[model samples]
Target: MNYNTENLDDKRLVALYKKMLLPRLIEEKMLILLRQGKISKWFSGIGQEAIAVGVTMALNDDEYILPMHRNLGIFTTRNIPLNRLFSQWQGKASGFTKGRDRSFHFGSQEHKIVGMISHLGPQLGVADGIALASKLKHKNQVTAVFTGEGGTSEGDFHEALNVASVWQLPVLFCIENNGYGLSTPTKEQYNCEHLADRAVGYGMEAHIIDGNNIIEVYTKVQELAESIRNNPRPVLIEFKTFRMRGHEESSGTDYVPKALFETWETKDPIANFEQFLLTENILSADNIEEIKIKYTKNINDNLELSFNESKIESSEIKELNDVFNIIENEIITHSSEEKEFRFIDAISEGLKQCMERHDDLIIMGQDIAEYGGVFKITEGFLEQFGKERIRNTPICESAIIEVAMGLSIAGMKSVVEMQFADFISSGFNPVVNLLAKSYYRWGQQADVVIRMPCGGGVGAGPFHSQTNEAWFTKTPGLKVVYPAFPYDAKGLLASAVNDPNPVLFFEHKGLYRSIREDVPTDYYTLPLGKASVLKDGTEITVISYGMGLHWVLETLKQYPEISVDVIDLRTLQPLDTETMFNSVKKTGKAIILQEDSLFGSLSSEISALIMENCFEYLDAPVKRVGSLDTPIPFAKALEDQYLGESRFEAALKSLLAY
Candidate 1:
């Protein structure tokens, strides 16, 4: 309330004026274009420009921002050329997303602007990540994220707030209280007096500002951004405003009371600020008109140029880096220098080596640091790497994943361990939607690996024991790696760390300590998307991964006469078709084993692929053996039958007879 504009010289005031006006003018022209069938759609930020413009102007140039679609001022204030901004709106290949996504669904890494998704809450979580990277890198940076009043209702909003506070992350959460989210009023959204009031429970500082007052917004946000950098912590600001138009132009504002709209119109941010400039004798009538004409011509020229640009073609949409680009590193050649390592030890060594090689590599999870995680895989890692690299997190799965993405954006690689693979359900959205689609949508490589400790037989029951690799294999844009042996586990993990894409690395808890083998003592890596022929023969081929591979090998010991070619599929996503088909062609029969249930599993897809491509080479129909189609039970008797040795024996017997 005590903020003043006297200290802001005429030059700075005029610059702020231009920033607020450009977005309004561009959106006005965009509205005309939408009706003329030139642009496909539009979101108007007519009255709410001050909140976006003021806040963006308040931050340092190097600080990152994540803004929603309605924040046109954030784009305009950043000085993104009108032509290029229009080009993006017009779906031109010259735009930030290269016409991959229209509107604000794409991020511009060059501009330090992270994009928004349809689901608003997750972006708030993603902001926590960028802030974490800044803190970890020892940079004087703060991340600002925006959302509407309704967005606070989501669990992700609360989860992110709690994580940022608990970790003391430097994140400035800005909420634009635009009265309504689509059609629902703020009253219907929550019972709190103000959205900022919710910050009390999280122990986060809160502030409410007159959003329509540009001077107040700029002053308060600038102060907070500076204070937060000096003493890092999370803070929330509720900017009170109302949208002049509907959520989108097409959805008219019939739900808004006419009286309320008229009242807000009188307090219009741009108009009030202009009147202040006039009252202060900073601008005359002619000067104001000249400014409008200058901007109008600029807007017109950009719009015409954008309309002339060509649309993006499908062929130009290829991703720059291959998702499963296997690093051509030397394989384990030191046979005599090898040492016996448990499956868990191999994983730990792989991560340790990767972290040592890539200085920016970070690992995060609940109880991962100090406690060394529940399985003790990262034991003594905290003392070795320090808390900055080996970070611990709250039970905010959603936020932790987003932080990994933020690290990726900050030129760092990360490994996120899901304490239990089944717990991924709590934070699955960002993994599937944000991290997986990041590169495909905007060419931002999500250089992160998610470690999923999964599989049954440990009696952890349904919530802990799960083979979720199938879920990711079905989702394009993610690499799924499941290794059976300790050697493969270490090598495949190193390859995953090398991959510049999102990888789901599944480590079967049942094998973490139960399985041990001679692994290379020196640093080495093996290629992903390549299956190892453990035992090759001509009678029949058996394919499997993770615990299923171990089960197949153990059951085959009973029948030595059965000449079977056993294949361990190291990476499930980019299936090694060449090796699988070559082995199947010679054997003339195949049986796929999996720890996951039969239906809609990786086995189904692999079987389908084999039937489609290798029909001529097949002597009998391809068979699949998997756990029972039911939730994994805690009872020992039921779990034994579910993943029984009899199932593997039956499949081998049936395939060999063919």
Candidate 2:
């Protein structure tokens, strides 16, 4: 430890010692609770307390700290009330997540501490977004993220560091190399001696510190933090320490050699740092003992209070609806003097309007910069918004979505473009597991718009042409929007940008240039979850969206005698049941059409919905039309046959005949 006692004043030294002491005491008490079967799981940073506490001390009060499960000590330094922390673990109503999570899975928004993703690596990218936000706002605050040695193996770690380095965002990547990632030793995890060595690959400043020495950890972090806040760049610091306990209380120590465990036990961060304070004459033995007693009493009292609080009942949990808060702006209809726009042009114009309205709206995706997007949806965006708001990201899907979630946490709305909807399969984890569950779990909503260019007919094989809306429609928290006209695309996208929850806005490849409408030159937002009736008739009702709506319209044109009523369900999720049921009840027959595969299709869901609500009004059985179960073939003939208009016409005829 290069830090001298004279460098830190007596008061600062004492504060540092106490900060490290609280987490250690809390960890010891948590183990006791674990044995009594009071807590569900326990992951302690016993010997790594210095890393969490020291970094917390170094960061500015307003700076964000994204902490992993093991870094619970940071909550103490952040001054998050002890009762709230205990209440979370105790599954009580007053916890950050209102008893939704059973462990250290919640973050304090007031304290600028974001809750961690269980898969710790994603938080690194999230921190990158936080840092990006600070830089964008020109705020003098850096973001510090914590992770374990084992976490480096995850791909997001590399992705985050690369993005941070490329942008020169002020981010501090703290890796607590505590010998093992769960049971796997450091030697088995990576070939490098120090995790900091990997930082060079990402063009980040690297530092290695003795994590057991509190003074060393704090002094080094403080020095790096000062530089980061001023110059704004990422710095990776590896804190070498050991975990005193096995992965959890029950994991057993047999996997770790007894001698190895004993050696680290002697070098325990809390006791070692406490002895150093006494040696330096910074604290008396009585003072050190009093501090421990004071914190222990505080923790125990909180534990009691948390246990006495009411558990979150099912009804109470249900009160936290899918989306937390909807920032519903008044609808400003497009005036009569509006201009006509192509579907793709309307999308770009809508985003431009959003960016013009809110400074916090950011656009991110691959090739979305000076090169514009491959489809040129973001053409001229770079010149209009500049690079800070318009980011050209690497082809890393999961990290792109995760980083957007982080920006949303920092009070910014992000619009992420997936080059093709099929490519979203590469980033399914964050979208389905994290992004979808965020609001329901902790009342945190990431105001993000994922723009997916989807559907077949352009002859861009299976990967490029896909209608994946059904996947998100099945998910609980997501809102799926697919517009068939330019006006709907522009208006719905405006609504999606203003929407407080995550929205999957699907733009069909076929309709990008082919569809045109008199879109309002002025800003206008269409109501989400409200179906638009394109035509009204009496014989049969056709329900469709995206490119399929065009097919339904064309098929209706050929059969003018059939008297078909057409409904465009602009939003798949939160589907407009009233309009759909009313139309079906009037016609007494329904034909559901979609571009996705027939098995488990969106049409299948609507079929079930119709049977459940409008069965009595039906004069004929409902029919569904869609592509074959096979993957979208590259051959134009086969692809045309797969989604041929004849198939759609046949389904409509069959339903009408029955």
Candidate 3:
């Protein structure tokens, strides 16, 4: 269906034509820079400017947007300084990234633009989160997410759509069907003829539009945005357009068929829109010339300004050092009077206190709301708070984690539960890519907490009984905490919640219900990098945490001859090197123990820390005691043999002999 430009006013049609021209000019210049070796590589939205500008103009300025790498048109139209865009492409210090993030990872919170994530399709989930936050905050705003047709084939796209549909979130998912996914055509990527058709499975409003027709693109998006704002439901719009150039500047155009290029070139969105403007008499020849001249001058001025601007000083790094400095100038505001609470109760109370402090804080997972979580840690939360605060999500691990990351990015504190510790693998991508690297990449904090019931001892088979603390400890920018008792659990959880980073808080399934201890009633926080000395001795230093602390306590009682100093390294990311070194210095020997496998375990990290810091101080080589390389066995006898306790006994005997 063709859209007639005759219905629209001359000024609006001319403005649309100008917007389409801007991206083409910017992209044409960028291509020149690329060929001249001034820029490394880039993906240009040359022929697809109408789709970007139309969709962006359709939404309000207060609304949020998450765009993919090839979304320069949207960013440019949204007033992302053209010079910064050019600088980013040139890899200069004055670039949008400041040499830290990639060129396309641009965003401005002031402009209500959430940063773009590089991964395909995950932005849809982020859009959902932003929309949810808007709803909760009582803001009349929609979140529009842009991605390629190729992204629709990803599991994240389906998962995101399913979540948005279930929650009836206000999100506009725009798919730019640019024909090729880095040389592979859409027909080779998916079975569907139109990408918008796939949205029917999620029961969402779906439409396919001629992306080249600026009026049609704008009208459809405006209507959809209004529908979502009123009813707050997910909408999917597929824009059929084509890329005028190869996928990136570095890629050769040989892979694409000449016939396909010829066919698509005739249907170029910018060229078609320009022709429409002229035929409808919406833009005079003089007006077109004036607009080109104005844009050229503006682009040149921006380029000159950015080039001459002072580079982001490396000395400015210290200014950003305290960005996540949670402990800085913190007043110990806890009341002197304290009340008693159990470990499970403390976990629940800590969450409640945090939620009360931060209105943006949300807790969600399976059985989390009414059931109060699997272990009743979140019991009475739904009754005390509303369903919005304490949510019960479907048993979709990947969806839960991705949504948490999305919410966190949208300025919300999300605490997610992995019903079982072993189930965290399902949400590993969001944890690793979105959560762990977000701060480092885009200077945005992913302040999220993943509470998992970890460890073994109770008969929860191999599937349910695994201490996978090492899996996250190995990832940088992720803080892993294992609290032995209720007091520490409450304090550490409070600290993690207050921290401006992602934290993995592992609550041992064995200790959650079995172990009970007195916890402070008021809000109190523990230092993240500090360790606690459970017991002091001279001969050997036993470095352990979580369930291993119990074994260390028991072993010390049995072996009077082995004067062991037990140190609980609370936070794994910034391990207490000073404490570990001092303890090892006094003891002259070290033993690391944990319930996980020795290969690629937290024990290895502890051992490395010891060797790196106080190798000469060590009288004997640092020994590690952990589970066998094989998976945890089902039988009690086999499980006991496979875990760290047996190895701990053997290591202690070996250290005594040494």
Candidate 4:
């Protein structure tokens, strides 16, 4: 059990011991704060401090780090202020997120930390992405990502590891095998005896270490970190450690047996290291006492100072707005005479133009390069823009999105395509945790565009036919754009490509080849939050988007007497409320229509917005027309029944009658 620290100086050994002690003390302090009602509940990183500190110390300062929630030791050793961490626990203004995030959600770009994304194994893909970028940019920096053993089962982990191994990315995939994930142990989570063994399947070099032993953990990590930096190849390291506390501050320890607790307590990494230092004559008892007193005094003084600091003012609402700063006056100008173009062609041209204007923009997806994408919209792009700019990605949706997020964070504008909108669920974590919440959590901007071919009318069945715009619309800090026409498609897509935030660009599969109008060959940009009034009428206001707009237009042609004012909600998140309310107030009636299911769709939100703003002006109650609450059937007759053009007409007629 006696591990030699002969290679390390006395000062270095003491430093390693100090690093392990910080998280232990911080965890104890956090528990006390939680009990006293000063801080909110959170997971404690008590027994696993050795692994966190040792692995972090192995990496260079310029390298990137993506830590999970149970990475307090890593954050503490990296010199994150104790008071700011405390403020985060308290959900106070002085916290890293300024009260917008939970405790343990730490991120700091200044320290080369890419932030902790909480959705389990997805961080591995993100780490690979950062490493890929570092390689592409020729930066001598590796990306180290930490996760739990439970994360290994996710498809994202396998996909990312495979890609990293194939591409030889400079990444260190560290799994904190802390025996348990919430209530389930590793045996219950994975079938393999050792999690590190799984890495071999992906062609990655795997390592297994005693995570409780600081010396062993540090030595193994140092060797791997050097190999990764020298060869720039991805490696997976599984650190077998134990959780000294429950999963989180709110978790009950009843599930853990008393005997197991006593056993782990005796093998406490912090106490064991202290004893080892004393027995080896590296540190006397007096030195141990002096080190503890110094750290305690430092933590206590910083905590008191942070607590005494004045809280953020309520009137400073503008501070939150400062997080998103749009570079104004960069708008591109276009001629008033708009020429017609097909929706697919417009989308293709928009991306080509964006890539030409901004060198940082890169496009990738299934069949995007040689095949020019599934729809052939990207035809000739690979030739014109080179393979680097218009690259083809494997059929890995999760890895594709994770790469886009990482590239965006590294100052590249990435346009990632999900072959079909329905498959977006595979990459939901990157879109939600990293893309949508990047600016809000870590103060980092993600200028990434996710182009998905959505909507159903071609009988593609449930798998290929879907409108998941509602999913992204429901999440804040993201822009969702569904253009109805070719001009809007070109303009809106151009705008989205240039915007500083993450955008979900939904290109209706039905509209892509079916619709065409006069779109200008020259470059143009449209305002993202603005909606266009297609046909102005006074009888009733119809709010619709994407393929639903076509249905409404056709219905208007059939019923000339209805005299409807149609408003196209081009952008869903920053909804054109002014135009929407004005149209409703002028008509005194509104109808919201979409192709998505009626339950919790964007149509419901449109109805609520109308009712909230134009309730008094309404001549009748607002109505919504959408697909029935059922899956899109494979049969033509069933599909028609589920989603019909007549349904929109009926809703409009009902609104007009009222």
The best candidate by lDDT is 1
**Candidate numbers sorted by lDDT from highest down:** 1, 2, 4, 3
TM-score winner between 2 and 3, please give it. 2
Q: What overall lDDT, based on C-alpha atoms, would model 2 receive against the true structure?
A: 0.86
TM-score of each: 0.97, 0.97, 0.95, 0.92
Model 1: lowest-lDDT 10 consecutive positions: 316-325
Residue 374, candidate 4: alpha-carbon lDDT: 91
Per-residue alpha-carbon lDDT of candidate 4 for residues 1-658, written as tens digits (9 for 90 to 100): 4566768888888899999997887778778878988776868788888888998888887777888887787788788888887777666777887777786665687677766666777777778777877877788677898888888878888888887887788888889898888989777999888998988788888889888889898888888887777788988889888887789878877788789889888777889989988998989999888988888888888789778877655445665464454566256878777656789989988888988888878898888998999999889998998877787887788888888878876777889988999998988888887788878776778888999898888999999999899898888778899999999999899999898898999999999888989888889899898999999899888889999889988878888877778999899977889999999899999888888998998888888988998899998998889998998988888889999565887777667776
> Which is the winner by TM-score between candidate 1 and candidate 3?
1
Task: Pull out the clashing pairs in model 1.
Answer: 129-403
Distance from true location, Cα of 633 in model 4, Å? 2.3
Candidate 3 per-residue lDDT, tens place, 1-658, comes to 2556555677777777777788888878777767877667777777788888898888888788887776766777788778777777655666655666666875677566666666776567777778888888877778998889888888778888888898888888889998889989888999977899888888988999998788899888887888778878888989988887878867767888899889988887767777777777776788789988999889889878766766555655653552343345242456666666666777888888888887889998899888888788888888878999898887777777877877776778889999998998877787877777766555667778999898888877788999998788777668889998888888888888888788999988887776777666788888888899988889999898888888888877887776778899877777788888999999999998888889988888779888998988989999998888988888899888888886687788899679
Query: In candidate 2, what residue range of length 10 has the lowest lDDT sum?
Result: 316-325
| CA lDDT of each prediction against the hidden true structure | 0.87, 0.86, 0.80, 0.83
Candidate 1 lDDT by residue in tens digits, 112-189: 898898889889888988898888878978899999998989988999999899989999999999999999999999
* Deviation from native of the Cα of residue 122 in model 1, angstroms: 1.6
- The digit string of per-residue lDDT tens for model 2 on 1-658 reads 3346657788898888888888888988998988999888888777888889999998888889988888877999999898888888877788877666767677778898887767777788889888888899889788999888999999888888888898898999999888888889988999987889999888889999998888888888999999888899999989889888778777866788899888888888777777777887878999878877888889989998888887777674566454545566567787777888999999989989989988899999999999889889889989999998889998888888888988999899999999999999988878887778788777788789999999899898878888888889888888899999999998999999998888999999899899888878988989999999999899988999888889888877777787878999999987998999999999999988888888888889899999999999999888888888888888899899888455998777777777
Work out how many backbone clashes candidate 2 has. Answer: 0
